[model samples]
Target: MDPGLLYDLSMNDYLNFLCVSGYNQTLLKAFSGAHYRCPDIINIMDFNYPTMTIPKLYGSVSLTRRVKNVGSPGTYRASLRVSAGLSISVKPNVLKFDKIGEEKSYKLTVEVTSPGDDEAFGGITWSDGKHYVRSPIVVGGVRGVFHVLDKTQFIDLGKLHQQLNLEVRRKRRSKALSQIAFVGVLCQGGTVDCMK
Candidate 1:
């Protein structure tokens, strides 16, 4: 190798290394909590079931490094550690129903827990009429029916089948009942389910 060219190459490598590891290298750091929204919860109910929305937040830290003579300059990166303070939590993960039915308007309550305060409001109503599982429902005057599907789950496949069964009977009054599998209510939880 040529002496002059080798000296120049070594000098370049040394300068590059010094530039990256020097105490004067600039670094910027920031810690932030990114805004996050809660997931939506919807379920079928013989009557409307009281529901709640829980909000969440994701916290992260960002860092940037600056180098004077690097080929591609410096870079920036951000990360979040999984910890109690890093994530926001909601109270009462499941909302309780005070009074819910398709017959009458029901109220839903929401409780928030995190860095902020808790709030409670009344008069939140849900209607099965608005969302029909099948067929376009006519607006106004036609009262919607609230059929109980499950006493524990409030909404279940068996209950939906029952509602459809009733609709079929209403449509075909004189027709013989179809060969539908009958589903009986199970005594698994009963009142003990509410203690959870």
Candidate 2:
């Protein structure tokens, strides 16, 4: 039911509280830094004072906690010299999105191309040369062959419809005009024109 059990933290968890004195104190002085002063202790028997090693003691101590798994990725982080009598515990390190593959594959393909100069190759020190590079050496252009399909392969409705409609309209208009013209000529020529 405990969260620690779920993470298997209880299996290989290690807790160490280390106390050092004398030469070690010099090394730890920076770690204590402006914080916890060793506590003064009093004992009834001859007023025996608690040594710096005791719990209510002066000076500083370091506590280190390390947790790891052989099969899984473990977090290891440290922040030195936080507050006096206060030690930092860093757990569960985070991985950034950039570290993981979260972006779509299409997003990675876009980039810019910068121009470069040939003089730079001859040992010429160009200014702002850091941004310049041999302009990506574009080798070839996109080349492709196109083939046209035969006209007989398809009966194009658009062209066929236009041609048929044009012919029919022309024939109808010509027939109507010819009939009108013949009637006009016959009327002008009198009744005998009907025989022709």
Candidate 1 residue pairs in clash (backbone atoms < 3 Å): 47-101, 48-101
Which segments of model 2 are wrong by more than 4 Å? 1-54, 84-196
lDDT of 2 by residue, 20-40 (tens): 133244444455442333323
Strongest candidate by lDDT: 1
For 1-196, candidate 1 gives per-residue lDDT tens digits of: 2111000122323333333443122321111122222222212111111222222211211111111211212221112122222232222222222222112121222212222222212222111222211111111111112233344454455566687788888788544554353323333443335323
lDDT of 1 at 14: 33
How accurate locally is residue 94 in candidate 1, as Cα lDDT from 0 to 100? 23
Indicate the worst ten consecutive residues by lDDT in candidate 1: 132-141
The estimated TM-scores of all candidates read 0.15, 0.15
C-alpha displacement of 136 in model 2, angstroms? 54
lDDT of each: 0.26, 0.23
